[model samples]
Target chain A: MIGDKIQEMFLENQENFLIPAREVAHVQAENNLNHALLVLTKIGFNVIVVLDKEARVSGLISIPLIIEAITGVTEIHFDRLDSLTVGEVMRTDFAVLNDDYELEDLLHLLVDNAFICIVDNEKKFQGIVTRREILKSVNHVAHEFEHRYDVQLHQESIFQ
Target chain B: MIGDKIQEMFLENQENFLIPAREVAHVQAENNLNHALLVLTKIGFNVIVVLDKEARVSGLISIPLIIEAITGVTEIHFDRLDSLTVGEVMRTDFAVLNDDYELEDLLHLLVDNAFICIVDNEKKFQGIVTRREILKSVNHVAHEFEHRYDVQLHQESIFQ
Candidate 1:
């Protein structure tokens, strides 16, 4: 069926889907909120991985978390950024995948997340699988299928 | 064969994928950065819609944009939040889909974006199609296909 074909496609292209850890912007857990904020703004990604001194995945931090940490009852305490650490406010309750994850596994987790952190058996950060990659794979499969079946499944133009 | 079935599934479940505009958080273009930040923090989304007086989508403002706006060469000028308007800092070059967008159109656009804004003929904001919903739809289709084919395509548990 189509599911099997999709699975096959994923298996064939899984290696290219991962954005290597080196390519992803990340911060150490001990880093201050100000530094973390700089990294986030410079990279233009809302969330980034937090790493430990041993190069293991610690957690994830985002702009929202920083905002929440510095917000007070009626005002934002911008001064708090100077005193807080990334580890103090970072979210630890996120999902991660080991090296042996399948395409279905990636698809299942991405239903609720924009990206999935990949880790090794030692809990060290490996890389990330983003929804963009999965969507591209799906698109590629659809196009290939259309060609093979000799049918036009969608309009030629993209959504305006 | 499999691609045809997948296309049919997408067509069948397209209606349930959109998150209505009313349910989405938004701010008027005239709103100050402080108000926009408050809305973003309260809603827990990094980005939100910017609407004009006529309720048409003027642009989008994100936390990163706000950060870029307030940060100077040496320090972050938090006071600028009171002076800046959402319209001045918002990104206006994003892609938008009309009301007539199809499932494939959405999939194609979402390959590069986390979400696509849905607008009307007058360019008024209608709603949003998010990657989360698309992933859910894809998962549902895969499970259905597995059942109909009497095959186990994936392991029982999701990615750990």
Candidate 2:
């Protein structure tokens, strides 16, 4: 039943989101940032979504990589833009959630990761989800719930 | 008064959207696909939104661009791929509309190009708008309309 709700939620807001999978692909952390840049250049939008060994969500590869790369880092002790690894700059503080969680929880967590990476217990990169999707899904579910409740209440009042 | 509505509409959907100036700036375009690739890679995924010179919304610079670029017409004829401009492979058929269009009109045009490029009469890319934003606006507007009409109807019925 919950899984059914999940699918329903996904459909209601499918158009509302520009998912990462739709936007870009997940790259291995071991890959060099320069290599990711080269590969990502061909990918169109330059975001390197990092995936862990389990393939679950890891971190974001952002434009800052290029900004840092080209302009180099200012805060570094060295007077040089040392080539940063995906590890050096990737945002690991990103938020992630399981699909099983209530859509409400997802909506709140979505504030962190631009896109939430959906994963199984195995931690494999299952699919990404976004705030738009969650909101859309929640709206649909609320509407459906209201309609169902309305009908039920009407029948009860008539009986009463 | 109209300004209020326009601002209201934009303000309403601000929550659902990541309305940052930095979003997708790197990958946006409406010309040669090859050139788009170059620009997008340089910019990276702030989720660059593509626009035509007149500034009409063209299509989004997606991660798939890189994936597609690796093959976007290249597989069939690699030589010609380089010759292509952002316009050739650029997504031309869009579901774009002016900011003045009613939310209902937009929902009806959800044919393709999920994101609408909000443009001026000259058709320059002003901002990338999304269904997610419109829905919130429409819902708020509908509630306001309903409340006003409900009050009016209540007064008229008492007179009757």
Candidate 3:
């Protein structure tokens, strides 16, 4: 029953359930370009998600993308970086995962993504999950395994 | 004498000695935008460095930047992504490490970089060192410690 309960918990644990959406950084599509850059640099995040008027996920912005924008990679004037808006440079190519999806499904979605947005069944934006957060989960499991092995070794030594 | 030799070897073990720069993917500034994208996708690199005609490190490009460029983030038509050149979009904000720098110096350089370009004393491009490669080195050392501990424990058990 304990194993079954753990399995059930793992299967039912969704993206929003692991971490609050608000903890992740996001900005409005209409926000100024300088503001977006400030959020990204200040937050120390590689990527920032953009939201639409209805609070739906729209596009993603990254540090490298901003660098590209400033350097005229996207044909923008370097001097005008501060004057532009986030919508002017954010990319639509982003991965979004369902908030209610199981852990197994979440892993599959993260294979090619550094982080992914979580959306509800009706496609309402929830939050995001980064590979760093998933790695923390994996570390916790590994620590538990190591602890159990140590206990087993101690028990065997005492028996001997 | 042996300890001094080990310390000398460790200190002199620079970035280029550990990982060759040619192993990393790079492009020239004059390369076609589409060709750069193809190299990035095919090589499966998160970032690609741009080299100048004299083989000096120039700029850096990333997949997200390419995406930003294609999405008209800088106001270009998505269809024209291939018509452009890499020089138009690459950013000059990158860290470069000296090939002769010590391992300790490499650690400091990597604190703010995912990877750093390596160059010899003449400033000629040598190669690169990624966070992944450094992590691998750490893992190898940890593994050696673990193996040694296991061997010591086995010896102790036999003695008992």
Point to the candidate with the largest DockQ. 1
Per-residue C-alpha lDDT of model 1 across residues A9-120, encoded as one tens digit per residue: 5556677888999999999888999999989998899999998888788899999999999999778999999899999999998879998886678889899888999988
Candidate 2 — which residues are off by over 4 angstroms?
A: A1-25, A38-48, A54-56, A62-84, A111-113, A119-126, A131-160, B1-90, B104-114, B120-126, B131-160
Model 1: chain A TM-score against the true structure:
0.87
What DockQ score does model 2 reach against the true complex? 0.07
Candidate 1's error at B37, in angstroms?
A: 0.7
The pairs that clash in candidate 1 are A2-B2
- Rank list by DockQ: 1, 2, 3
Put down candidate 3 lDDT per residue, A7-53, tens digits, no spaces: 23233423424445667778887887666766765565668888887
Top TM-score model: 1
In candidate 1, which residue ranges exceed 4 Å CA deviation?
A149-160, B1-4, B146-160
Per-candidate DockQ vs. reference: 0.28, 0.07, 0.05
Which model is ahead, 2 or 3, in terms of TM-score? 2
Task: Name the docking class for model 2.
Answer: incorrect
Question: How large is the i-RMS for each model, in angstroms?
Answer: 8.1, 12.3, 12.1
Local accuracy of candidate 1 as per-residue lDDT tens digits, B20-126: 98999999888999999989998899999898778788899999999999998868899999999998999998768998986678788899878899999998888
Ranking by lDDT: 1, 3, 2
